[model samples]
Target: MNIQMNNIHKSFGTNRVLSGVDFDLREGEVHALMGENGAGKSTLMNILIGLHARDEGIIMIDGKETYFANPKEAERSGIAFIHQELNIWPEMTVLDNLFIGKEMTNKFGWLSTKEMKALAQEQLDRLSVSLPLLSEAGACSVGQQQMIEIAKALMTRARVIVMDEPTAALTEREIQKLFEVIRALKKEGVSIVYISHRMEEIFAICDRITIMRDGRTVDTKDIPETNFDEVVRKMVGRELTERYPSRHPSPGRKVLEVKGLTRQGWFENVNFDVHEGEIVGFSGLMGSGRTEMMRSLFGLDPLDGGEVIMKGHPVRIRKPVDAVKHGIGFITEDRKDEGLILDFSIRENMALTNLFSFSNKGFISGAKEKDFVDTLIKRLQIKTQSAETAAGNLSGGNQQKVVIAKWVGIGPSLLILDEPTRGVDVGAKREIYQLMNELTERGVAIIMVSSELPEVLGMSDRIVVVHEGRIAGELTREEATQENIMTLATGGQ
Candidate 1:
């Protein structure tokens, strides 16, 4: 099946998100979409998946004009979309989730558990995924859950699949397995629309590439005919310099020290220290409790035992407010769930943690809020027309910038960032790296948790690798090679 969108125009009131957007995907080929934050990729995907209606356009499926009123209609037309965020039930088993809406039924109209379980096992085996059918969905790793979502879509016989940031949460080995599955799907004549900010993945898997800028098609070219620099030029309309700025050594005395930090089942005996003007990285597998430890530090998660010493003084953090008062801020890994209030305006969201500073005696001051957000917006280089814009309407990269800005506004002594550049484009990623450098120059102690090895090596002054809820090893800049880090991360001696 081939999908073609012609002259698609969509708008929310006076703000036109997409203007004459044109793109196509062909069978047996992966079409990669490239864009920066606020480039209208999400809006276009939403239109294709029937989440939003196009003000004017033509959608042709298999060379026939069509319109999808809802996701069910799109699925019925053999189109499926796997979002960046995995949509799976945590409490449900893999077999139950796979056959949820379309369950195998018995004569009494009850679910046929055995039949569904067998089918689910076959699907998993076909993809060479080794997860048990009876295991709860959330109990599995992020990569495993991603595979389950893909299997569910394949079971529906979807001819065209739209995958957004598919490899954001995957390890190198797991990514290879996913690429293998994608090749198998291509062999089966399934057309795939792959959207990602990672240039390496795009060049590796895509047959053709389409670049979008400001909601309009920029150019379409074969993957082999172009290099990363060329594709980036088209996607961002500018040449990017070095991705990571040079690390400046301004390490002072220890600003944060943790001795035997334990959260029982989450993490055990975690010990590390971050000095003033230093960026320390936490690298581990998906479930290695990097996020849990950070949450505990921010007072969002309870610590069973251990201690957090700030500037050689132990501080008790019972809640998020206490952490904030202690001069600590956290930019969560899951932005949509923990970071931002989507329905709120940009100014309102930025003022969430530090709203009291802008209020006079419990009375809010709109002018002060605007002044604070306006300065941060300019400083962060956030791409938005106005401060009144809804945070949800921004692109993933811009939304991430907003989250960072919110914390920067609070002027914390210590900042914890998890996967800061997860869904951000290369251009924005460079900006973020610069921002991290700026923060370090200001003598702020920073702790970063990321799955990207290159990022861990590039940004961190020191790296700590965790495996199975324990500190596997630690390395300085010169000792942090990929092989060395992987050996520790994979539980090697």
Candidate 2:
């Protein structure tokens, strides 16, 4: 399959998402789409699959002008899209999710359960995934759910696959497996449109790359012909001096100390301490119990046995409100589900944690709330039309900034951040790192749990490795390296 999109233009109300964009895909080649958030990467692909109509453009597939009426039409034509936000039916079983609309039927129009299970198992086996077909989709981890999405796309036998942020939730081992699958697919004459913010993955796997900025095509070059700095400069339209901002730390008294923290069947006997004005990074594999431990600390999950000490005294955190009242803020990993309310306006979401500060006599002060929201919006450099704009309408990077701003408004002594830059762009990630530096300078302690090893190493003052729900080891900034961190995370001496 060969696809060519020329002069694509799209808009939602007054917001122009794509303007005069050109993208093409050749058979048996992996083409990459690189851009900052809201740079029209996803929007352009959405238009191709008929989720959104292009106001002005020409789409030619195999030298024939074509436009899909809907995603179903595109799927039938061997074009499949694995979206950044997954489309799993949480209430349904994994098997049901994999074959939702394309179930097999017998001669009498009866559903062929045996055939479907066999087919599903075959697809999963190809990807080296082990999942129970009868288990509810909601019970799976984010990484497992990502694999399920990939398997669902492969089940269609798509000739043209558009994968947006496919590796964001995957572990190192799974990513290698996916790269192998991509290689096999290319050998079978399948074309791929890869969209991601990770520069390493883009350069590693993509044959050609297209850069977009502010809803317009910037440039397209062969992957080998372009370098990381050049790609970032083209995408953001400026020079990014540093990927991770440098911070000078001056440690103070201990802000948070966890002793014998145990969550039954999850993490056990975890112990660590984060000092004031320091950033403690939690590094591990996807299911190494890093997120589970953070959830227990934030009161989102129950702790079987543990001691949480804050400011030299033991504290009890039984709920989110309790944690908040104790001057602790948590930014969860799954931001769409746990951190932000999509339907609410930016101001409303930012004020959720600090409502009491803006309230008097059981009545809310709109002026105070607006003032606070405006301040954080400017501080965090969040791009939106206005404070009245719905959070869901913003780009992925802006939504993450909003989630961070929400916690920053609460004036926390200790903040827990999980996967803070999972899907964010390079420019926005630098800004976030700067913000973290500023926060630590103001004497706030941060506990960051991340899957990206580079990020964990670059930003952490102290690194703690988690392996199978236990604290395997801790490394100082001078002692930590990628090899040693991975070794500890995998239970190596």
Candidate 3:
């Protein structure tokens, strides 16, 4: 089970994303593919999986030249891809999802329930998962769904597994379980191509690291031979002095407060406060109701019961538009589906939140719009050929930047960011942190909903932990520690 991709070239219109890219995956080795967004890592993997065609390349499997016309062909050749975005049907049972296209059939072509269930159970057992086969896949937690994805791959008897950001949305406990499964598979002589934005994972789990930057392979080194700083420098082509920007939070008057926030089945009695010059972090495990609370506060989701006070005035926000009028903005976690209009140009997306500022009577001033968009694009360091370029054409990190720039341009007194750095790379993550620091310095309060413990500890002036739709505890920066946060997050004292 070996893969050799040589001289790969890919282009989307005039944008050349990959040029002369090369990658190698050997049997029984955990090979990490490291790169910044748009560094050609995703493009190359897509070509191998038959999602995209390379303009020029030769793919050799076990020293034999091969071509995959479609995903089925690649799958049949013992390759399986677990995308960063989990693809599963919520209405379907876990059993059905695992045997979707590769179902076993009897003599008359009838689905073999007995065989499918047995095989699915075996795969789950291999991963040490306890999910019921007949349970609805959608009703499970993010961690459970991830394990199901892995089970599906194992059921295919894949010799090479490509996992892209497998732990992006998983909790620390779930991540440890996932690592245990990965190790089990490795013991069975399976080769893995692991792609991730978190540099620590590369050092912790991979055998070798290959860095890609600006559509080219920068370098490859054994895990033991290279250091984190060197790997980051290769990926971004520059020295990174500090991972997080320095923050001096000078708390001002309370700008926003939540009293008795409740959403029937989602959360209840959620309460918190954000000061004018502070960043308040909401920390919890997945499904702790952090997201639901923010969505309700921003009026994206209805609040069954609560009071939102802005600048010491009680305000009734029943919808997102109302929240916007009251100087509030939200950046959702699912950026692709919720954050940006993919078909719209970058300029239009950037202007979305602040479009009213450019409107005179009813007509928008193109001059004002262009000036603001240009300034945001430059200030945020978004990489795009032109403002007219489609938002969907940009890389994940750049699209996230566009979303932030749009919301930042709106001049909201309080901004809510959910999973702001989920799939963003190291350099982009640092930039976002700096942006948050700047926003808070300007008297703009921020409410950050995050699953990363380190992020919450590093950037937050105060931390709020939620458990089972309740405020488990609150801690000041000095009082917060990973051990204490975890204890409270799991419903401890």
Candidate 4:
């Protein structure tokens, strides 16, 4: 399962994605692919798996030149790709999703239900996962769905696996389990192409690292030979001074307050208040009801019992429009599904939340829209050729910037950011943090919900821990620590 990609080149129309990129994976070793968004990391992997044809390259597999016709062909050849956006069929049963196209048949040409269940159970057991085979795949949490994808890959007996941002949706416990599985796979002679923006994970698990910048390979080094600062410099082609910007909070009047907020079956009895020029971080493990509570606050979900107070006045927010009308903006966790319209131009997506400001007599003003978009693009340091570019075409980091820009256009007195920097690179992450500081400086209150502990501690003026549909504890900036937060999140005193 050794793979060597030399001088790989690919282009989409006039946009060159990969240029003279070189990557190699040794048998039984975890090789990391590190880069900023739009650096061609994913593009190069897509070429390796036959999703995109390389315009120029030599792909050597086990000392022989090989090119897969398609992903299925690649899988049959012992290469499996578990993408960031999973391919689980929601309505289908877990067993059905596992054996979708490659189902076993009995001697009579009937579906081999018993055999499939046994095999699926075996794979899940190997990964230390517990899931009901007959349950609908959609009912599972994101972390469970992630494990299902891993189990599906393992069922193929793949000698090579490409995992893209695999731990993005996983919790601390699930991530450790995944790491254990990866270690077992490595011992079993499986090679892994680990692609992620998390530097800590890369250094923790990978044996070697390949850094890419602007569609070309910058350098490749052994994990022991390189450090975090060195890898970041090579990825962004600059010295990134700070990972998180410094913030000095000066609290103002209360902007948002929740009293006895209850979302049936999700979260209950939630009580908190966010003041102007303050950053309140919600820290919790996956499915700890943090996101569910945020959704209810933004009026995306029904609150069976609650009181939302804005500026000392209790207001009813039954829908997103109601929240927005009251000067509240929300940036959802899933950027592609909830934050932006992939097919729309940047201008269109940015204007979606502030149509009234950019319209006159019910007709949109292109001039006003362009000016606003340009200003935010410049202010946010969004890397794009034009504001007219489709948001789907932009890299993950730039797309996040666009999402933030759209909310900023509304001039919200309070903003709720859920997983604001989830898949963003180190450089883009700093920019987002700086933007948060700027927003707070302008008297804008912010409620940030995040799974990254370092980010939660670095950016928040105060932290609230959520555990199993309830507020576990609250810690001020001076009192918060990783150990205490984890303790609270796990329901410990």
Q: Return the TM-score for each candidate structure.
A: 0.95, 0.99, 0.94, 0.97
Where does candidate 1 have its weakest 10-residue lDDT segment? 123-132
RMSD of each: 2.0, 0.9, 2.1, 1.4
Model 2 segments beyond 4 Å from truth?
none
Candidate 4 residue lDDT tens string, 1-493: 8999999999988888888999999999999998988888888988888998999989999999999999999999999999877789989999999999999998899999999999999888877778989999988877788888988988899999999889887888888888999998999999999999999999999999999999999999999999999999999889988888888899999999999999889999999999999999999988899999989998999999989999999999999999999999999888877899999999889999988998999999888988999999999888778898999888877888999999999999999999899778888888889889999999999999988999899999999999999999999999999999999999999
Q: Sorted on TM-score, highest at the top, how do the candidates line up? A: 2, 4, 1, 3
Q: Which candidate number would show the highest lDDT if scored against the true structure? A: 2
lDDT by residue (223-340, candidate 1, tens digit) is 9999988888888898886767899878988888888889888899989899989999999887778888889888898998888998889999989998888789899877876789
Between candidates 1 and 4, which one is better according to lDDT?
4
Candidate 2, residue 334: Cα displacement in angstroms equals 0.5
Runs in model 1 lying further than 4 Å from the true structure: 89-94, 127-145
lDDT of 3 by residue, 184-284 (tens): 78899999999999887888899998899999988878999999999999999999998888899998999999899999999998888999989999999
Global lDDT for candidate 4? 0.92
Candidate 3's TM-score: 0.94
Name the 10 consecutive residues with the lowest summed lDDT in model 3.
123-132
Q: For model 1, what is the error of residue 204's alpha carbon versus the real structure, in angstroms, after optimal superposition?
A: 1.1
Q: What is candidate 3's local distance difference test score?
A: 0.89
